[model samples]
Target: MIETIVFDIGETITRDDRYWASWADWLGVPRHTLSALVGAVVAQGLDNAEAIRLVRPGIDVASEYRAREAAGRGEQLDESDLYDDVRPALTALRKAGVRVVVAGNQTARMGDLMRDLDLPADVVLTSGEWGVAKPQPEFFARVLEVAQAAPEATLYVGDHPANDIFPAKAAGLRTAHIRRGPWGHLWADDPEVVAAADWRVESLTQLARIVSA
Candidate 1:
């Protein structure tokens, strides 16, 4: 039985189209250009951070983030940003006695944005507070520790195959590849990679139906 469901924040539960769009605007690139570049980076199995550096040479992420924060220019996630299936799916799982958590590679500052959405997660955590981010063994290891869950019993739901699916599986967790977002649909044609997933769910509603959670 799946005892816990670990969620990916952006593009998984939260529709971050506006978020990335804003990033493209700030970086002076077409939104689609930035989007395609991110996908290309993933397709090549390259690190997103390095890709960002390569795409826009000398772009200072931290400085841009700080400037946006000071100017209140960053697009904030609202309740409407939640996907249509997010609430119903998570609610069903929680009602079924599943432990739901929001664990992502975001900062503690992003926690405020998550709270604004009023998501139905039992616990919300981030890399900033945890001091570790995804794709790192310590990140997954620590999450299991906090939930007191055996990796074998945990189910991780995410969009990115490499960052989320592969790493979660590496840590001994079952993974569900939700094919709605970019990374999810990005690798759809790659049968070998997609087939490795324990489940391929197009909608959170479908996932709720199949999962014991």
Candidate 2:
């Protein structure tokens, strides 16, 4: 009888690996280094947006990659090229009477990111706009209010452990962890992963079934 769903946008709904490849190119650093940095920061309890802000200012990591792409010399890239079935999946969930809301730590270009990808989101909550990021119960609180959903009736799905799992559980919402590759070892290993979630799946399509069930 789940009536609402909260989703983390980047990896859970859309493909984020290609975006990270772009970020690695733009920053002029190896993708592994960026992955390590992000993992370390999140391991220390910083959300994704703050971690990027903290690291980007001090180092010129991949900053030039975007300019090269704009000049048509870098890797073939476009947000449009990376879309999945998330939009249609969400539309179906809404038609089935589930309220869908998106929450993330989109830092500077939240609007541009969504526009560039044509992602379908009912409501977008970003750390840059909210001054708070995920893993904090308050972030989930705000989204629940916006979606007019009771915590007992809601479920949250995301890719990260700390940001998505712990807080949503603390807020009394069921959680689904989407397991994918390309993230560094900064994440918890198997035990934590197994312990933190109510359900775990490999893709949002599986999540569609969970909600309907």
Candidate 3:
């Protein structure tokens, strides 16, 4: 039985529209331009942040991030950012005796924002807090450590195949490929994704049923 279910943040639980829109505004570009650039880099298997570098060559993204915070326009999150199914699905899982965890490639501030939302998760963690991001064996190792469960009994759910499905599966955790984000939709039909994912779900509600079965 799947005793624990771990989730990715962007697109899997929350839509990233506001996040990207804020970046585009800060960079003084039209929202659609940055959105297109993000999709282009993602399609080319490059990091999404590459879009910023593409817009302004040789710019230090970290420094700009700090600048934005100093300007009072840093990362922001609220219940509005969450997907419609997030609360119901996570609550269902927890009530069903499953441990629901929210861990993702997000900033430490994002972690704080997520916890403030009061989602029905047993734990909320982020790459910034952990000092390790996904697709890294060490990150998944931390996940297993926090789960305190056998790898086979823990399910890792995310939208990215490369970062979430492949690596989590390699770490011996059951992987669920959620088809909602840019990466998710792009790779959903790929043969490799199909092979790596133990389950493919369009919504978290489906995941509730999956674990129940």
Candidate number of the best lDDT? 3
- Give the clashing pairs for model 1: none
> What would the per-residue lDDT of candidate 3 be over residues 55-154, giving only the tens digit for each residue?
8999999999999999999999988899999999999999999999999999999999999999999999999999999989999999988887899999
Top TM-score model: 3
The candidates, ranked best first by TM-score, are 3, 1, 2
- Model 3 global lDDT (CA atoms, 0 to 1): 0.94
TM-score of 3: 0.99
My TM-score estimates for the predictions, one after another, are 0.89, 0.72, 0.99
- Candidate 3 ranges with C-alpha deviation above 4 Å: none
Candidates' C-alpha lDDT? 0.79, 0.68, 0.94
Candidates 1 and 2 compared: the better one by lDDT is 1
- Model 1 alpha-carbon miss at residue 50, Å: 5.4
lDDT of 2 by residue, 100-119 (tens): 78777664355355545545
lDDT string for model 1 (142-211, tens) is 7787656778778888888777888889899888888877677878657865776888888887766666
Candidate number that wins on TM-score, 1 or 3 = 3
